[model samples]
Target: MAKSQTKTKTTKPPVAEKAADAATTAIRLKQDLRMIPLDQLDFSPLNVRKVAASAADDAELLASIRENGIKQNLVVHALSGGKFAVDAGGRRLKALKQLASDGVIPHDYPVSCLVEDEQNATVTSATENLQRSAMHPADQFEAFAQMIAEGRKEDDIALKFGVSVDLVRRRLKLARIAPELIEQFRVGELTLECVMAFTLTDDHDRQMTVWNAVKDSYHIHPQSIKRQLTETAHSASSSIGRFVGIEAYEAAGGILLRDLFDDNAAAHMENPELLERLAVEKLQNAAKVFEVDWKWVEVHLSVDYGAFRSFGRVYPQDIEPDADLLAEENALMAREEELAAANDGADWTDAEADEYYSIEPRLREIEALQKARQPYAAADQAIAGCVVTIGHDGALRVEKGLVRPEDIPVAAEQTEYPADGDTEIAVTRPNVSPPTSSAPVPISDPATTLRKADGISASLADDLRASRQHILRAHLAADYDVAFDAMLYALCEQALSRSYGTEALNISISPFLAQNRETLHPDTVAQKMLDALEQDLAVEWMTLEKPDDFLAMSALPLPQKQSLFAWAVGLAIKPQLLSDNHPTPIIEEIGARLDVDVAACWR
Candidate 1:
């Protein structure tokens, strides 16, 4: 076996310098290196390192020792018998023992040692363990790369090091990362985690792009970097991919890139537009099944609750299943109920638990299939349509009974008037009589009366605003200049007068304007508008945690502040008929001036 040589610098010291150094350190002791038989050595209690006992690693170490002999000498102290206790290189001693046990060497194998006396034996052991140099990560990566380049399989390398194949693959990936990024990692500018994230994509251009984008910011977390790189790409686990299976997508010429080392690794689809087109085509084809029962069938890629808000819904009834399905459903329900009964404080077997969990998904599938087989009512089919969309789980989602605004029924109203030549006559019912007020209701402060003129309930406020919204629109349409001035005046009054003194909480519009908004039932138009405004503003205001934040948000520029104030005022307008059932001339004039069709706004 060959011995490993340590490199040395051969420059000799001057004779005077060497003598002075020897004199300065004359009190320090040095040990002489020599060879001794294994049986003459004992294990030290004060050894700092515990040798690994794993079979694979132990075997590897033994192999290395048998192939190249011990490259380093053990530090030992003299004991009573011609024996010495080894205080350092415990792993090496174990490896040599393993080799001897395998009969590769004699039981009393000759081993090399650096002999130190008892006084400094512990210090020498500690110093050897502490001063041992570790291989640099860059060098390790390069070594792995060299091994791979030499045609060594990843599994073979992992076996050689007693590590996971995944670790070897990871090291290889780290080796292939952009040289600049690797340099950053080596120089301590980027963290190991950040560098590992860059290895997710082998595209050097993309890695550099993301690094340049966020390199200045402190938010260089691994997840953040991954998100930036993959935001434009859809994951194979996404809804679209699930709806359109990976096999089908690939059949349609879609490409998926996978990470070699990520756990629960996600596949990235390169062409999003192609995926979406495929998804929509699938949805459209699915919608054809409902063509017979629907007046019109539409396909949408994504559907939310808000998408159905503008339409009315009608439900399908009497969706009866066939004999086999009926029997199957009943049996499933019975089994589920029995399982549920047993689950109440009952210790169930593993088989029973698995069976219980399996019942729900199968039952849901049956129900959905049965529902698709059902027929819609003739009236509903005549008035409503059907929609096919993709669910979050990438399954077909069918929304039936959607009626457009034009399809909704409106009740007819009739009015009677006197004939032109007939004389005016008053007819009173026999039991009805007009009664005069006993006395005038006493009024307190006129300002208080004015404030209370419009009902103060939340519902009343909503209806009044809806009724007046159209009128406010007409007013603004009549003169933009006047509307702007009105907004400024209102802002000034509220910002100055309202702040300086206690004024009435008169946030609502005039009572006369709100009067025409009254309806048999409370109107939701104003509430919906307010809800939308709040939702839009919530993104800006919801994050505010203090009064100062709110104040800062409120302190908008003059134009923006005026625009918001004007919008609030506009909500008070009503689109009802003017006095004497006359058409609003100002609306007509504005419509003409702006070339706008008034009917669209009314609709």
Candidate 2:
């Protein structure tokens, strides 16, 4: 029954031809501008730009669309079903879509578009966006600045634009640049690199000063500008600033200019005059506090190498402290050690830190008091003074007891040479004549030779004895103490008359130990020991400039002279034996007592 009734309805040839002609006309006119429903339009997946439309731009587009309708039509391609995909004007499509979503327009509201075939979508998208010029960097910076001025936070602006907060801040730095430099940037006369350097300081005058100073020179670079700005102001991290402290400087009405663009936000001290004045004041206060005991105390902000040229140094004298004072000092030292030990295992709190700082000053004051107890010679004190200045390390430095060359006392000339009271007594003696080679001699028998001698032989014996005595006397005069010991030993040996070397009934040392240079090998260790000793001794040795100055050193206290002599003679008895040979008993004993390291000595 169904087969009998299933008749296929077909259009007449003329009607079909008329419908096909109508469709062809519609397809041919598709590229012409017309409005499509917003719901029917979709973004083209082949769009070249990935950035979404900015909020302000979208808002502006929405307002324009509401006020004047779409002035420029979006390029769209026919997609599956009845939908159209945007190719070139995705942003415009988004603006329209946002308007429809906000109910500013109907969801099915018409969106003006220039319809294209699907095959040309990618080429149309690329051509429309890629061929357009991007906004200039200067304009972008200025725009960001304007947004900021309009009370928009950097974070909010970055979020709205889909960019980083840091990037927005960086752009904002450029915006706040000197107006003149901004003008230069706007005209493309200044590079971005040099423009960034102007962000170091906000002072337009200073920026202009640096720019004008370097613009005509070969040093017109970002680094050059940075250096000039840095030179004009002192960094807060500088040694002088750190020494004076930021809080203290600011308390004294100092200004610190901060670098906003720097990642560390570095600060520069603008009030250098105030900083210098504070440093000098602190130094003067310290000098004043320490000047009571000093004959004269001079304060200097900086000491050049030649600053010491006009000054001479005076040696310090030892002054024994009272028992009560010594006990108190020892107690303070113990307390300081306890405090240091307490801080060893833990971090210090603010209070603990302050306590540590407080203790340090008291410890330094105690040290100064102890040092002040050291007495200088009256003569030195009369002409010498101390210098207090800032050290290279930015700490207070006290150079005590300096004497100028002009202050050195001149010695009185000798006037008693061959004077009336200084009598010269002469003693008459039997003249001894020099023997001549032609002098006659007499010989005696072998048995009587011991009893009788030739005159020439006796004279020769006397001459040899006299020459030996002269040599012995010279050695004794050089080291009288050593000579005294040697003479005593000789006298004792003669009294006992040992046959060690006295074959002819005479006692003598012969000074043979001094001649055995190689066997002793004292120079190997002595040289090194003497070098160290000389360095220690130089502190005192440097004081004596002339022979008379050394002689005048006797006016110094007994303890001072002994201390100098002690240091000088410290290496005199040092062990000098090498690894090649055994040492003398006395040398070995001394080495053992002193725990001398032979290998270390050799090294």
- Maximum-lDDT candidate: 1
For candidate 1, lDDT tens digit of each residue in 1-603?
A: 899898987865699779878876543333367788987888888786665557866666666677668888888888896988899877788878777888888879989888877888778778887898767676678789999999999987876765678888888988988889888888877877678777767889999998897686523445446656666777766667678878888999987766655666566677888888898889878888889878888777665333565566666566558778778889989988898898562777889888887888988888877876876567667768877887666688887887665665452222223466343543211111111222122122234445665546788667755755665678677997655545444433333222222122234342123444435122355446544653343112111222212333344555655555654444434455446487778755654776854444332
lDDT (CA) per prediction? 0.66, 0.64
lDDT of 1: 0.66
lDDT of 2 at 186: 77
- lDDT by residue (298-401, candidate 2, tens digit) is 77655543345445455576677656657766777786677678857277677866766576667667677778678766555666677787654456778877
- Give the Cα error of residue 299 in candidate 1, in Å: 2.8
TM-score of each: 0.54, 0.40
Off by over 4 Å in 1: 1-42, 50-71, 78-84, 95-113, 150-156, 250-253, 319-384, 406-603
